[model samples]
Target: MVHVSIHSGLLCSNAAVVRSFGLAPKYEWFDTPEPSGKNEVLVDVLAAGLHPRVRSQADGSHYTRPRALPLIPGIDGVGRMANGQLVYFVAPDTSLGTFAEKAVVDLRRSVPLPETVDPVRIAAAMNPAMSSWVALRRRVDFQPGQKILVLGATGNAGQMAVQIAKLLRASQVIGAGRDSDRLKALLALGADEIVSLADEPERVAKRLGEAASEVDIVLDYLWGQPAERAMLAILTQRSDRSRKLSWVQIGSIAGPTAAVPSVALRAANFHVLGSGQGSVSTANYVAELPALVDAIAADKLQVNAVPFPLSEVETVWHALSDIKERVVFVPTQ
Candidate 1:
């Protein structure tokens, strides 16, 4: 097999503290490895997204440790193989990652891409957008025209959840977040109502309870104080406790743990479930990518993406640090 020369954003060999990726050299050039198995295909990378999970994985703070030292830093990307089939793929767990000019992915894990969609945009939005898309469609069996609530609606994933919930034809979409200004921005993004987590616990609970009275589904990105308040609110204020309500836990941005009143769960009709790695199977997850990408391409789903060349990861590292917008590395550029 002939090897191809390529560039990649490689993580340092040793574990180190990186305050800003600007100072940490993460990109390098190396020969691409050939696809080793029948199930694998080599891809000419187009774009790779820089996400909080990527950053954490690079820094060794994520739940899943780094694949290996001197490894590439992207978990997912959009690329095309020599056969000319454009696809969006999740990189296998290996040192060679999607940040490279070339990557190897299992064929089963790859989803065919539509020509109507811009590869870079979908590459940037897919990971964040997957949470709600999967949660509502698969985990919760969400119904169209139902009322939904987004607990952490200001962040990238939360914001996408708001749009996805509306795109799914939810009759009402309520957004709640810590920042008042950011929460207000969600109203234009499809949130029918907005609640602030900045208020006192009692006040936040009251507001959330009022909203929960009509909500059929709750997409929770924050699992700490806000979730505690919202859960309590549901327990105390749900007009009809018998009404079906599904609370899908997608992220733990606020904190890893939440103190919940055991009585709340035992008494309320609300169902609490989680969505992500283990909850949703790989085949089901891959199956939904096409529709999610289609939604993005059609402009039904909106997101903020900042693109940078693979060689300029250091220069745009600070920008990537901002969770409000997604920063993508375009290797072809």
Candidate 2:
């Protein structure tokens, strides 16, 4: 058995985790676990993504809840193994999460990282970028010339959806966001048009309505008010009722549920579906990573990542309010 020192955030079963937020979990030392499974390898963790979902997992609000206490609090990370090969891997079990100096993951769950790619960038980009890439590539039968409308385009995931759509040769990409400045930035990131959702519902509807005639797919991240508005807009612009539009619901940052109108569903050419865990097969999602990481290495996927030390999780954790950049935690040497 190889013994290694690790600083991991321990989640207590009885603790009110959500109330603590950036202050909870509290890191402590632990002996690394021995690997014992098919393709299982012990890894020296380099960088772990401080994703918003980690907080949700700790608080017991995420879809994938913590099954036991004293759990580490990372969903995924980039690590260097005993063999000296660097890879990115996901934690199938929350009991042995990625926010540590060492972890054991099935080698099949990991994708080998190129030497040219920064591990921090890959750690930050994959979760957010994969939503749309896998959704468009697997969920929907997307063609090169198809047009895409990205709802909540100002957020990190939405921004990545825009980039992926363009990289996949989307003929037209419309970005909808509440922030005009960020929406303008999306234009340079390959978005052909921008729709501002800061206005009243009627005005937002009008904007979406104008573009509804051209949108072949809608990648919705904010699936509350903006989604309702988009639906209303599509209802008004149903030029060809026979032409179906694919709407892939990925995240619900706006709210858990929306007040979707019954008429809106019956009136338009809309085929709404979800794209996340349990929605897509795990093996297929893993298959897409090599090429996706290659894209990041080639600088095709655009993402801004800010590195912080694992020891400073309490200090810098509160600074994750900026959705434009990803906050990554590098294990302290």
Q: Pick the candidate with the highest TM-score.
A: 2
Clashes of each: 0, 0
Per-residue CA lDDT of model 2 for 121-220, tens digit only, reads 9999988898999999889999999999999998888899999999999999999989888889998899999989899889888989897666889999
Question: Candidate 2: which stretches are off by over 4 Å?
Answer: 1-23, 322-324
Q: Which lDDT values do the candidates have, in the order given?
A: 0.79, 0.79
Each candidate's TM vs. the true structure?
0.88, 0.91
Model 1, 207-308: lDDT tens digits are 888776778898999998778778878667777777777888888898888887787767777788889877898889988988987888788888788787
* Candidate 2 accuracy as TM-score: 0.91
What value does the lDDT take at residue 172 in candidate 2? 96
Residue 282 of model 1 has an lDDT of 85
Candidate 1: where is the Cα deviation over 4 Å? 1-25, 319-323
- Which RMSD does model 2 reach against the true structure? 4.0
